[model samples]
Target: MRAALYFTPSRDSDLTLAAAEWLGRDPFTGESVVSDVSGSDGLVDAPRRYGFHGTLKAPFALADGKSLEQLEQAAAEFAASRCRFTVPELALGRLGSFFALVPARPCDALNAFAGDVVRHFEPFRAPLSDKDLERRRKSRLSPRQDALLCEWGYPYVFEEFRFHMTLTGSVPAEQFDDVEELLKTSFAAFTGKPLPIDALAVFVETEPGAAFQVQSRHLLVSAETEE
Candidate 1:
């Protein structure tokens, strides 16, 4: 099994509901959600398998002697140490041929928070296996990305990390406009709004090809509540 640290909104939040519907699966419950997007099940299958989330820590096997229970406890402590913050606005944007909700503008606080999550979980991550390394290399990574992959088990981290909640895998050039319009219409309620970064979720993949499911969620203490 492998576990990842990810940012997914509260189970009941509007964004979460919309994402579950659009992705056709809910990570929190491991249930299929119905949506009206044309060919949604097929169009989003790639991301649907992982559920709706932005990667904070890519999936990794636990380091020797580290247990899920231990990781959960450490995550809880980490969450407690953080104060809830927000991304001023999230806009629908294309990353290459894929579409995702991305921050409209960079936010230093969010970047710092993601960096901290990666570092804090480093000790719990087992070194990537040779097979894993080979697979990562197939992407033809740049020198810096290759170095980061060797050190962090993921090529994207710290400065290279770009937070994105993937909406679909690569869209066909001819269908891109239609799909983009469909996504915008479907997520119109929550896109381009301040997004709360209030919780961290532990998502687990039981086997190599299985879908990831939320194992637990830890909420950051709100400043008002902390006071």
Candidate 2:
């Protein structure tokens, strides 16, 4: 099994429910949701398996001597010690042929938060297997990213990470605009709003080809309370 750290809205939040329905799966519930988009299942096939979330720490196997229970406790501790914040604005965007919800501008707080999560969990992450290393190498990576992959098991973290909640696999270049419009309309109620970043979730993939599901959620405590 592999585990990842992600940010997802509260289980019963309207945005969470809408995203689950649009993606056709709910990581929180481990159930399928019907979508109205034509070929919706096929369009979101890639992200559906992972459900609706933005990764903070990419997935990795547990390091030797680490137990899932221990990891859960550590994650909960991390969450409880950190303060919650909000993303000022979220907008629909196309990253190449894929679509996602991304912040309108870079936020230092968001970047620092993600970097902390990566570093905090590093000790518990097993090194990437050879096959996984080679698979990452297939993509042309910058010198820094290659180094990050070697050291952290995932290339997109820290400075290279751009928080995005993926919505589609890869649409054709010609279909990008249409897909974006479709998603914009579908997610109108949730898009361009201030999104809360109040909790961190641990998600687990039971096997190589299985869908990842939420194993637990940790609420962020107020910074004032930590004093």
Candidate 3:
């Protein structure tokens, strides 16, 4: 089974609650948008899998047949020492070909946490196969992006990263503006007021093709409120 450590919103934060509302507004919001984008949606009214959450680490298969307990222990140990930092107010924004809500300010704390996740979870990543290499080559990678893929087994890490809470599956080019507007309007209900992010959540994928489920959450040191 493949597993990933992700950035989930706090249970009590305004943004977290808002995200749940968005997901409830549309089941598609609570699923792996990447998968839907990669496949054909021929089925009618299919319930989607997974939901809105920022990715701290991309998915990777367990190495050397590791046990889940071992991975959990490692995660708990790593999480215990880490305190959460406040995520500044972010708004709905566009990411390359997709749209998501991203941090408004460039945040070092976010990058630091992402680095920690990579370092902590490096032991579990299976070695990249030839197929993986081919897939990555097709990606339009910058120097830093290539470096991150080589070192971390995924692109968009460290200096080449931005934090995003995904809102929907792949939107076609024509519906792009409409979807963006819709998501923005939905978010608008939460943005004018304070929308704080203050926790890291762990979401677990149930099966090979299944969506992920929230297994646990961690609290961070709450940042002093910004005026």
Candidate 4:
């Protein structure tokens, strides 16, 4: 089974339903938008076999063939030292060829949370093979981008970062605008007030038949007090 860590909204966050709805539409409507833009013939969710959210850790195979309990224990330890974050207001945004709800205000807290998650659990990951490198090469990078990719698997990190609730798969050059517009129209309700990124939830995909459920989430708290 493959395991990944993700940040999910707390129940208190009003954007949860909106995020879920956008994800639901992504498989169907989003597939078309991405297909129209990129000319890539594919389903948006075959690999994920699921919808979307911000990826804290890209999916990796479970190490040592470890049991879920062991992985959970590792994550629990990591969460203990981390303080909770109150994610600020976010606005819908367009990335290279996709759309997401990006944090509208400054959120150093969220960035630290992401870096911490990567640092603490990095031991669980094995280096990416040639095959993985080739697959991720579709997007070209600038020197700065390359540096970020060397440090973080993705080119956008820290200040160069923008949090997005992913809405589609990689899009082709042609259809970007259409997909962005579709998402903007569909998810406008979620932008009313800044949505709090108040928790981190673990959603696991074990096998073909398994469903990724919200197994657990840790709450974010003010730095002055313990969470």
The lDDT values for all models are: 0.92, 0.89, 0.65, 0.60
Which parts of model 2 are misplaced by more than 4 Å?
223-227
By lDDT, the candidates rank as 1, 2, 3, 4
Off by over 4 Å in 1: none
TM-score of model 2 relative to the true fold?
0.96
lDDT (10s digit) by residue, model 3, range 11-91: 555555555555542222343222322122421122135555788888777889686667776777676667656566676
Misplaced by over 4 Å in model 3 are 11-14, 24-48, 192-197, 221-227
TM-score of each: 0.97, 0.96, 0.78, 0.72
Worst lDDT window (10 residues) for model 1? 34-43
* Backbone clash total, candidate 1: 0
Candidate 4 on 1-227: residue-level lDDT in tens?
66677776654344554544444332212232212223223424432344455767766565665667777777776676667656667677766665567777667878877767766666776566567566666667777866766665656656666666665677776777666676667667766556655555666766744545555666655467772
On a 0 to 1 TM-score scale, where does candidate 1 land against the true structure?
0.97
Compared with the true structure, what per-residue lDDT tens digits does model 1 show for residues 1-227?
Answer: 99999999989988889999899899999998877777565678889989899999999999999999999999999999999999999999999899999999998888999999999999999999999999999989999999999999999998899999999998888888899899989889877799999998999999988999999999999999999
Among these predictions, the greatest TM-score belongs to 1
Could you give the candidate ranking by TM-score, starting with the highest?
A: 1, 2, 3, 4
Clashes of each: 0, 0, 7, 5
Better of 2 and 4 by lDDT: 2
Cα misplacement distance, residue 138 of candidate 3 (Å):
2.4
